[model samples]
Target: MHQLMHADLARAHLHERLADAERQRLAAYVVRVAKARRAARRAERAREQAQLRLRLLIN
Candidate 1:
């Protein structure tokens, strides 16, 4: 999943560089979205692990 996000961002960056002048703006936006998605996923995993640890402590 992380790799997928990485690839998506890379592709978007590449396209931003290669795309026609008009489409480059959208490609840049796509790269930002992909980066945000990757950060969100990492945060979710960390939250889940913390919750699991709290559960273990309570039990």
Candidate 2:
């Protein structure tokens, strides 16, 4: 989480349009975005396994 915030802040601060509060908001945003991405990947793998099982059943 620490790295998350640090990386988040650094990324946010890079944006010329970002203000302080916006940068802080970006910390949470970044964390959530990363979490969502990880969740999506897990879901994708699960879906693929389900499809494989369905294929086996069909055969």
TM-score of each: 0.61, 0.61
- Candidate 1 wrong stretches, greater than 4 Å: 1-19
Q: Per-residue error at 38 for model 2, in Å?
A: 0.5
lDDT of each: 0.93, 0.91
Model 1 residue pairs with clashes: none
lDDT of 1 at 32: 97
- Return the lDDT, model 2, position 38: 100
Residue range 1-59, candidate 2, lDDT tens digits: 99999998888777745676688898999999999999999999999999999999999
- Clashes in predicted model 1: 0
Query: Lowest summed-lDDT stretch of 10 residues in model 1?
Result: 16-25
Cα distance off (Å), candidate 2, residue 18 = 11
Model 1, position 33, has a per-residue lDDT of 100
The backbone clash count of each candidate, in order, is 0, 0
* TM-score quality measure for candidate 2: 0.61
Q: Give the alpha carbon lDDT tens digit for every residue of 1-59 in model 1.
A: 99999999999998887767668778899999999999999999999999999999999
